[model samples]
Target: MRLAFSLFVAGFVTLAAPVAAQSPDPVAPVKEVMDVTVTNWSDSVDEWKGIFEGDRLNRLYTKELVELYKKASEKAAKIFESEEPVDPFDYDVVTNSQDGCPLQDVKIALAGEKDGVSDVAVSFRLWACEDNADTKNLVSEVHFDVVQEDGKAVIRDIHHVADGERDSVIEELKAIIAQEE
Candidate 1:
């Protein structure tokens, strides 16, 4: 009887161990569009701040934007390389148009997520709290249009909040490129 009980206990432990190992954890990886949008602001606030302070634009910018910036810089270079004097403002790259992340030391909060649109809105607040939050002191709100390109959610455009109006930085760049052509 003792030998039979030991065999049964060993078999039960082996069976339960595999089941426990296969269970998924409660934590989640940031894969979806919404998750990427939030993580970019929350996990990268300091990095964004650095960019605002004249640091290089990293992976946060979309490929389209980066290419446009390159083209704009090339155009400026060619113009400046000529004997004609160039106005600094007239021959500047689009990326240099804005200085860093619009908000400073603010907590990024998800405002909403829309289905089928792949657009996410995020609000930058002064600080975060579990309860009794204040809404009047919001730093700024920004809209992100994300697209899955090459298995990654890239920021296509940023609709920055300015003076109660929203402006798309990408759209502005496109217009500038168009005018130059």
Candidate 2:
């Protein structure tokens, strides 16, 4: 009887391991997006232009946000081809800045969750490359609204606060798409 009980316990433990490992992490999707952004920080401007477009966009963002980005990109392309070209997306959406140093000390945490959605807070410091005495250690925080879709987490929206201004990436994309129409 003792031998049979031991065997049953061992089998249960072995079977439970895979289930625990397969559990979804709420912070994973946000971290994936941030990892790619920081890794390609020093890439050329032309290369960075597609960072939030194409396959990456579809994979990282929610369906609604992806559609908005597509529309915004289309409008920006039209403006670029006109006789007087102007870049609609003048700033980097991810960092919320036109210029910045390489990101460091990146931290991601789950701020809250409600109704099956999670808010992931990401904070990072920009390491200043120059030896300027006046340049402060710049720190920024961006919050991602994440939701599960088809068993995987996707970013539904992004919230940014910079220079005393608050904005949503979704609304900004919509504004860009409506600019010339």
Candidate 3:
């Protein structure tokens, strides 16, 4: 469909042969992002908050989460700052404070786990903004994939799914694969 649309546009431009090569470039191609409307995002809010702000967040990771975080952290440390978000590929949590806009809603859909692999769907209202402050609904579908490690109930492989954010929780993976008990 995209190819067909581009061909049609080209045909029209050629048939209408503009008089000036200097004519301001025709309307620029608009980049479109998704608009998400999320509700009941509060449940994850606490979880997220704890993960971000909690000093001992690692302690709650049913064992598996700890490993995942460690692996992810290790991979991330090789590339980004420790304080930066674990999911560095555009991973951000929205705030409730914003202009007169719709409430910040993030609808998270979690898939059951089996054989150490689980899927989570994050449906939310991504508020469009000039900066991170203008918060407005702009995205609708967000998904995450998690993998469990041996003898652990936590997730080690954290994949956002939307973007190729394949990062292992550094410390966790190291603990598992590292030598010398």
Candidate 4:
């Protein structure tokens, strides 16, 4: 019995060792996507400094987010034209603060993802050239929610961090859209 048990344990380890060695890191693909998006976006933002604030702000978000904002902006414009009582959407949702914005003086770090109950949180970081009242040089850890959309991985929401507080881009969009009626 002892001999039989010892052989089974040895065989299990042998099989498991090779499988573990061959398996690629599950988080590697997530990191790659985050790196490309975050790094490229940072480069673009820095390159376009001193341009119109609107243009700069538009450049910092994903295409889906940009489109969503554009729609809301159109609605808000109509409201303003008609002299509405309340603003349809808070424009600060993207930047996470009323007046503050994201400035990427350096490339953002693409950290690994944390598995959540409903979605995955891909970690990232941004930095400033100098620390100020709003941001540290290293800023803080930011998280983007990755969801499988149409069989491909796309960021559905951003947990935006500005002025040291976290906010959600998708939640803000929902709130703005809900106010339409």
Residues 1-181, model 3: lDDT tens digits: 9999999999999989876544211111000001211222333333323232253334223455544555555556555556553442223322222232333454555555566445555554545433565345455443344443333333233333335443333433455444332
**TM-score for each model:** 0.45, 0.78, 0.35, 0.41
Higher-lDDT candidate of 2 and 4: 2
Please estimate how well model 4 matches the true structure, expressed as its whole-model Cα lDDT.
0.47
Best by lDDT: 2
Q: Determine which window of 10 residues in candidate 4 has minimal summed lDDT.
A: 48-57
Per-residue alpha-carbon lDDT of model 1 for 1-181, expressed as tens digits?
A: 9999999999998887755333221111112332333333453444322221122333445578666655554555565684442222331121222322323333333344465225455545423332444533445565666655554455566676667887776676566456542
Clash number by candidate, in order:
1, 0, 32, 0
Candidate 4 stretches greater than 4 Å from native? 1-74, 80-127, 131-138, 161-166
State the lDDT at 66 in candidate 4. Answer: 56
Q: Candidate 2 lDDT, tens digit per residue, 89-135?
A: 67766687777777767889999999888989888875455476445
lDDT scores of the candidates, listed in order: 0.46, 0.76, 0.40, 0.47
Q: What lDDT, from 0 to 1, does candidate 2 have?
A: 0.76
Which regions of candidate 3 fall more than 4 Å away from where they truly are? 1-56, 60-103, 112-114, 128-137, 146-153, 163-181
- Residue 104 displacement in candidate 3 (angstroms): 2.6
Instruction: Specify the poorest-scoring 10-residue window by lDDT in model 3.
Output: 25-34
